[model samples]
Target chain A: MGNSVSEVQTADDVLLELRNLRTWYPTGGGVLGGGREWVKAVDDVSFTIKRGETLGLVGESGCGKTTLGRSILRLEQPQSGQVIFEGEDVLKMPAGRLKQVRRNMQAIFQDPHGSLDPRMKVRDLIAEGLVVQGEMRRDERDARVAELIDVVGLRREHLDRYSHEFSGGQRQRIGIARALALRPKFVLADEPVSALDLSVQSQVLNLLKDLQSEFGLTYLFIAHDLSVVEYISDRVGVMYLGRIVELASAEALYDDPRMPYTQALLSAIPGNERASGRARIILQGDVPSPINPPSGCPFRTRCWLAQDVCSELVPPLREVKPDHFAACHFADAI
Target chain B: MADGGATGGAMLLEVQDLHTHFHTRAGVVKAVDGISFDVPAGGSLGIVGESGSGKTVTSLSIMRLIEPPGFVASGRILFRGRDMVGLSEREIRGIRGNQICLVFQDPMTALNPVYTVGTQVAEALLAHQDLDRKAVRERVVELFRLVGIPAPERRFDEYPHKLSGGMRQRVTIAMALANEPQLLILDEPTTALDVTIQAQILDLVRELRHRVNTAVLLITHDIGVVTELCEQVVVMYGGRIMERGSVAQVTADPKHPYTQGLLASMPTRAVRGQRLAAIGGAVPNPLRMPAGCPFRPRCGQAMNVCVTDPGLRNPGDGRSVACWLY
Candidate 1:
């Protein structure tokens, strides 16, 4: 579970691999409509999550980080892609097989208040997955639920209480417990600590890290907070409007970012002492609409280094440095 | 005593011994209990805290926007040497958007979606000023440009929904600056924007403050933002100020236990894989607050003397800390 970069890993080390994923939503019309625009929420995204390592995906809202996570989990059906999990294509799996595969993959949503069912008791909330899987009896489920509650730093008494009765942090703990109830190998935590208070935020982050080590689980940590992502991620990926702009080990990406978009993002962090004395790059406008994203390169509109070639041809994500991939035309030149 | 009021010459906003409370059926909740601070002319002060810290209540109290069941119980809100606590509704309305303006986090809620953003900003200007329609249009366009909205003329007639979140925030800022208010109160202004958009907005705010020379009262939970914008800061917790000092002094060398705890808990301050020194336990339940120091229950340095309130005491360096350890 140590956060070391395995330079020479066997093929067995790979747990989840996404190949050319495309999740598009038609806007303003039905399928029969003549003038329908597709919002490419996750446009041909490809990445992998190794065993027992956290892959942090950083992006602005509507930058397709959430959509990408959802698409990988098959929560949002992709238009086309291969969600290969342990040598099996989940996208091609039948409903029954998909249901079985889902037990190994779980999701923790952003809002604790909205994610947890307020009407259900904590015990049932955590046990619902186990109950659905039906691998354990009632007594076993009860014991597992009890054990999960304790593991997540919640007391046995909290099992009887409803979600509304608990604090935001506690509710998030309940959500975490629920996500971990089935002992999933890969967990997609989307902004898990975003809604929490500063003091409470650290507690949840620590819990997530501890759980990862204890259970030997891999994680796809998706969040907008750069600092939080850097703290937890072994490798980090920067996503711009529906595409992975840059991906590298956390140290490499932060120290010497290849893509202009990645550099701009790092500079945008408020009071980043680590990158002190670095010039701040405040992008002029909001992200372009995903429905009609800038052609060739999604980030070309806001990129400071944009040129004619940037708009004329798409920049393929290539290894510009050792283990560091970037999709900018000037990645090598810069 | 509100020492800050005496230090900063020509204090534009002085909140002294402010106690804003909510009189619900259960009991009274002291949302802002005896918080004192000052914002000098053209100076910026950040009120930093997490949720339930009374920072928002203090801003609302200043704006007189706290509704029924919640009222400013007692406090001297001296705005430009005028006591605003007992001002009549009609009297305060004259000063509300004219002399002081408020820009909150969500611009969508602040703006009227039915009307065009231009009309909303023009309306804000017309409410406090006597201007012709042509002049209003010109001023609105100018304000929009000043807030960094591109194609100001084209965007003038667009509805709030048409603008992006950052553009909507710029519109809100344009409205806030319509009357050239002396004091601007922003509550978590960039909390809802993307990091890059947030950077843009922060730059806009800094530039506007320099150009307009308006005193600012910024309420936010992010320490990085406060350190970047504000000269002075007041850290709040459980409806009271835990520490007050220059941003450099407080942030670099935090005095109070709560202040230290808050600064220590920030993920930005830690390296990768390093465990953060988090403050244990949740914020106190407002309905059932612990006696004396509200933070004592979770304080690592709790002492017997903490049973009694350690009111704001200056240890040294002109920084006031509300902890017995000082």
Candidate 2:
């Protein structure tokens, strides 16, 4: 967690910091009503992932979890805000310097099938990252590839195999191996296990956890599945319509959710343990369109406890309890 | 036709010792290997499994939808005392979408891009029933309304591509329920949809179940979806039923290691900062399935007994398990 740059002073403490992050896609075209209409994919979101800790980003699909992950890695440029990595603003860094920064910050995608190039062998795919960075010699790169292959529980023989030859779980392992090739300090695992089987998902998840401990890695684990997020995350952030509604320790968010949206999301999870005597707070409608999102509280349209005031004014995320920040007008009441 | 006449309390659809295999260039891949289960009248049975687990193949085999290179090799599918195996294509078609309807995953593919949602649903209704054009149109609007599609009349004119993912799925469900079929087969109907849309569709299914008393053979990988809708649960792996019982019995007191592992691996109801308990190894290649229990290679509690093929056997309390451990 040592700071590589002076600008990133709190080097040993925080691995990544996002301030007022906003990612917008332009919509509409030409003529009389021609104006740059933004989709507001990730709107005014802020969070910090500390060194060696996994920050779980939980939200429904299209709520900007993927967009946020990509933005943090600078895979997609943000319209505004700063992505401070190791105290250095990644958004402000030049291309050559950004390329250097990427060696320390890597990403694992949702679909293993789509992420990996089918034509490349597993060994070549893993070595691509190391080769691009030009950090190690060819022989060293090959050794690093083999070591990563073993670390992610893939056989040495699998190096010659293509992505199609392996199963979903095996392919995901290859993806992880490629990500860890450079020995990154921070990784953005975006729905890494979502496409995998329930039984196989656990294996990949456990593997990630073990690897994190071994390498002293920090993660911004983004996923829609709350249970998986809860299991892997030290701190949890619940997002809705491109804004974080609640941010707290995993236990606190699950045990005592202050936001109605958080409570509803938790209640939606089935099974006897959670379902027993717990009156599910079924939200009324679908998430509001990001194109023309709600004025104040984004979740007001679906929030059960939403009132006139909730619609009238947006609630600021304030720390109501120790390490628990909630964005709700009636956070205290909840 | 072993059982010529239907008994009063006979199961609505009884699939016994079913085997579906695909003849690939390499070899014959056993997709559904001697799997057996029953869906009672108006009861909901969930077939839970991951990809290549044979859950989808089981439902397709029942519907006689096996494509070229894939065929039902062995076993009987008794539907209302009739042996569906070796039935003529015409005879099967008479029963298909009439007595039993199938709502497949990806509504976009299941529906016709050329025609309106109403026309497709009307075709399903007209296929079995003797109805005039006006009567069919009336029924189409009614079906759309029943499935909770807003503004039925306006939506009926719109093509499949024009409708949203949720609306297109609603049209599929509407088509499935057009004839008020006794049995409905839904193969991961909501898997492609978002979570919020999934919740809506599940609610719609529950409502329809009560309204039509239609027995459902739901095939899905989501345990959460099964828990929310099903009464009986069948856990599948390597084209076989690893475990089957009442949802409460199977989920709460799982016996088979595969079933136990699946339950443990689910991310739902997990504490923060805990590592998910994942089952080791990948799903065995179907072309090269192990000689003994197909799950043995990945089974966390694999024993010497697992070397021998473990047939699905009754494990008391009306539960069935295909593991030597039980």
Most lDDT-accurate candidate: 1
For model 1, the superposed segments whose C-alpha errors exceed 4 Å read A1-10, A273-275, B1-8
Once fitted onto the true fold, the runs of candidate 2 whose alpha carbons sit more than 4 angstroms away are A1-12, A31-33, A272-276, B1-8, B268-275, B300-305
Model 1 lDDT per residue over A1-334, tens place: 1332212232688999888999999888766887888998998888888999999999999999999999888989999978888777778777887898899999999998988888899999999999999999889999999999999999999899999999999999999999999999999999999999989998999899899999999999999999898888999999998999999999888888999988888888987633367888888677889999888888889888999999989999999888899999999887
**lDDT by residue (tens digit), candidate 1, B171-237:** 9999999999999999999999999889899889988887888788999999989876888999999
Residues forming the 10-long window of minimal summed lDDT in candidate 1 chain B = B1-10
Residue lDDT tens for model 2, A53-133: 999999987899899999988889999988999888899887888898899999999999999999999999999988888
Highest-TM-score candidate: 1
Q: List the residue pairs that clash in candidate 1.
A: none
Q: What's the TM-score of chain A alone for every prediction?
A: 0.95, 0.95
Model 2 lDDT at residue B245: 92
Estimated TM-score for each candidate = 0.96, 0.94
